[model samples]
Target: MNLIRLVLCVCAVFGTQLAQADATRYPLTIQSCNRDVTFNEAPKHAVSHDINMTHMMLALGLKPHMTGYSGISGWKAVTPQMKVILDGLPELASKYPSVETLLNANVDFFFAGWDYGMRVGGDLTPQTLTPLGINVYELTESCAFVMKRPPASMEDTYNDLRNLGKIFDVQDRANALIAHMQQEISEVQKTLPASKPRVFLYDSGEDRAMTSGRLGIPHALIEAAGGNDILSDIDASWTRINWETVVERNPEVIVIVDYSEVTAEQKQHFLETHPALQSVDAIRHKRFIVIPYVQATPGIDNVLAIQTLAKGFHPQ
Candidate 1:
């Protein structure tokens, strides 16, 4: 009964638009600690908290409009062009900043990456920020559900670029970028041979294996790069598992999430020192690629992530 009320409430909030399931244009809502709203019109003075969300905005040439970025990390993987755009935004914090800091920046818009980090930082919700004339947008990919209907796949990435193009009013640039990305995806598609190699997405936490989802951007990148996600059975987007499972799956390639000043040697040492992991196929074959934490989400970095993984998977 409670579940039904929640569903009814959401449907009412988004309007009866879901009734026409076929319609592409409809309101979408994300439930962070609080519900954040997105409008059909353009946003100025936008503040992006999610790196991928920020990258999406940057792709639309919206960086100049971005007031400040919360949790500003992953400056390395950004292409020179994108980095040039990002360098302009002030670093508010390594992760989400305090509510007072955000208010000080005078942001008119708020975009959070995942509900976890942002919500954990404080009560920085749309309800709290809206009265101050700031609107919030949370990434749909970060929603914490298995989604009975199929989640967005690579095909949807192109469609999303078009949809985002409309929202940002960068239709021309969006179309051109999509054309270039599609061409690249096509070329790489031909190079990949038929083999479903299980892969591990290792984050540099040093304790448990914090990894990607079975269904979202990380999984898509793995498949796009011609590898299978070892943890694809887990429905959640981000998960942490034990070495027991790591040894059990024994992935062929390991994509390590490099952060801070952790060098390539340090990451390899973690794998090499672990007696259980040393014999793993990935370590045995020396198949490891350091994926920057930024592209871990769904954004411009995703394209580069696929390219990086493709190189590691099929090295010279």
Candidate 2:
């Protein structure tokens, strides 16, 4: 009798947990880029854009929910690990998918961001898709491109995960992931030294320096790793500034964003050889930290980016 009672108790606990997991009601409304998007039901066929956005979906175990992905192969190659996780999912487009491409796929949802895949006032925006019965979820970090927002922080990433969890009725998985990330970041913070190094992020640009400003994910990663973004004063996210401005700031460490478009070594060589940047402290000392493009963006790889930067900034 006692054994049966114990079994019933265990079953009841799990049953209650499952019920909570499926608690999200229909006609759910969530905010995306300062707009309210209502979902009559959880998206059945969805598409995500960019490596980072795809990483977010995969981390949430949304593979079964996703129909395809886009915006990766055009600029970045899928790493071996990511390819395995993708599990033969189709690439609807090598770059940004046109409205016809998405419409033909018959997808109900699109996960993209301003400038990430959908440009502001572009043909593939939420306004354009909504009429065609597709719901759009804009990345929180990219929200700054369309509206005024506070400085970038880890919470922005957390909020994305949380919102995705709610959207998919997988709040439990989302909460657990957020908790794990928070714990990881806290552990890293405990080991960090008191000194904060001045850091510069070099994404890609020749005549002018393309880099992250206060609104970009790199700014948050730099701060978390006990480093200061030299261009934190700029209000834009990813924008171009003159090389003269980079020379003026005199960063102690330069972070090269690694992608297929430009190799990290090539970018480092340019900085090392540039006549104007010769006097820069980072260039003089050869203090270059190469971070993969995915890690530098907003995704599960953010924790790894912080760890990599912390080690690079203050190597023991």
Candidate 3:
């Protein structure tokens, strides 16, 4: 009887500690795009911009806190899995939401980034929204566009997760997710070969190739998968580059960013038949790896992207 009573007391104490550990203090300040933003309390009504940012929020179980999402239908359709997860939630806007749109929805928090949803000096920005009682959190990877930032790493994705977890009082869940991703990446690294393939990311464009630079998540993904981004030295994110440079670099493999705007097959066909790229190794060998736009972006699917790239780079 005494042992049972002692066990019950210990369990009660343990539960209390767990609750306390996960509890967030109010009026917390966090860094966002080189600026300090403070939250008085967990936001009950939040909106995420872009599919990748929405995925991050959902992966952390922040759907209940979210009012709806935007910037998806304008670019890509939500996957069937995401459709089910967002059954009743409305799509606030097909593209970027106006301040009036957010105001009408009564959202207190917004999760977006430069070029992801809100553009620099655009009408819908932190400065424009903050005055109307809405708080904004910028995606870490997109910070490169607005400020001087180091080349993107997996740590950038992890940092966004950590910050979101803190803001939403879900640190425990965030920590567990981070741990799982880290473990998966480490396992992938264990199986990688010593030789890193020279890879180029093909986003789009008929006249000029739109590719990822060091500031983009694809650079980190390629590196994690034992491959090097041919344009890693370029100080830009997703930007247009002359096809001549691509021919000069002579990439061993091409990573195609598949999206609704242009079909991957079409992009592959263009590269295969292009007069300038006829001699390119990727086209000559027909070595191309197609990655979903969401996977290529900064989100939970980044780990899966790395795994896919690794297999494509080293099939043996």
RMSDs, each prediction?
10.1, 6.4, 6.8
On the 0 to 100 scale, the lDDT of residue 68 in model 3 is 94
Give each model's whole-structure lDDT: 0.65, 0.86, 0.88
- Model 3 TM-score is 0.93
- Residues 1-316, model 3: lDDT tens digits: 1222323433454444444345789899999988999999999999999888988887777889999999998887577777776788899999989999999999999999988898889998899999999999999999998899999999999999999989999886676666667877899999998998889999889899988899999999999999988998998987889999999999999999988767899999999999999889999999999998888999888988999999999989
Model 2, position 245: C-alpha lDDT score: 92
Give the per-residue lDDT digits (tens) of candidate 1, residues 15-58.
Answer: 53222222233343323323535554565667777566666666
> Which should have the higher TM-score, number 1 or number 3?
3
Local error of candidate 2 at residue 32 (angstroms): 0.8
Which lDDT value does model 2 have at 74? 88
The residue pairs found clashing in candidate 3 are none
TM-score between model 2 and native = 0.93
Q: Per-residue lDDT tens digits of candidate 2, residues 162-195?
A: 8898898877667666666776789888999889
Candidate maximizing lDDT: 3
TM-score of 1: 0.77
